[model samples]
Target: MHATTGVGGGLSDEQRIESAAHGLLRDLGRLTRALLRAGEFGLTRSEVSVLDALAAAPLRVTELAAHAGMVQPRVTALLQKLEDRELVTRRRCTTDRRAVETSLTPAGRLLLDQGRQRMATALLSALHTTPIDDCERVVCAAQKSVATLAEAMEPEAT
Candidate 1:
């Protein structure tokens, strides 16, 4: 039986890699949407993206926009909404008075944690039919893949 994936059907290495990448992106979008279905965590995808971006460290509005792949104005609006809910806090930067730094509040962190747990539980239950060894491999590969993408996006330190 022929496998549906293009990663190893006697194609060129580059072609195989590209096909796998396309598949990964397509499935990733579906998975992301599934995780946030109907605002499962009382947070919009954009809002969650912003929160996740801030998880690493506080960021200026421009930095946040870059991280979220959004325009500054839209990100500013989201920040305003988050601030109103006390899920995020923005303050003038100590090093640069003109810049505003945004950080997640404890509430925001807790919400994120809860959302992660929910998704984990849901995926675990849904994967009951899959073999345990396959699940373990997928989980490990996903973590490494995510880290690889994160590193690719980072700029070189000065």
Candidate 2:
């Protein structure tokens, strides 16, 4: 019996890992979309990304655009929508009067909290449904994998 031969036929370790990674990514995407659809205060993926970035701190339009990986004009349009909802506010940068800075309002923070809570609830439900031992092992392995990737990807210190 070759290492790659099984009921499903030959699959190298790399092939198995790649298949698992793709499945995980697809499931995550599905979960996110489902959660957004089920939630009362729904937000588009781009909106959520922008809000997550702004959660760190207020930033100028250019900085926010970079953080959200969006073009300035698109970000500006999104900001306008957020402003209309009173979820964010924009003001002239004191130090750089020519630049406009945007920040999450209390409402925005509340929405972010709600979104996080929904994610936590979904994750907890999954954990509860799975066997405890299996969950623990999988989670531990995932954490180690993430850490390994982060370390490998980290830039060299000056």
Q: Rate the local accuracy (lDDT) of all candidates.
A: 0.84, 0.78
Task: Write down the TM-score of every candidate.
Answer: 0.80, 0.68
> Candidate 1: lDDT over CA atoms?
0.84
lDDT of 2 by residue, 89-151 (tens): 999999989999999999998998898777656655678978777877876786687666556
Which regions of candidate 2 deviate over 4 angstroms? Answer: 1-28, 38-40, 131-158
What would the TM-score be for candidate 2 when compared with the true structure?
0.68
Worst ten in a row by lDDT for model 1: 1-10
lDDT of 1 by residue, 11-69 (tens): 77767667767877778889889877623679889999999888888999999888788
The alpha-carbon RMSD values of the candidates against the true structure, listed in the order shown, are: 5.1, 5.5
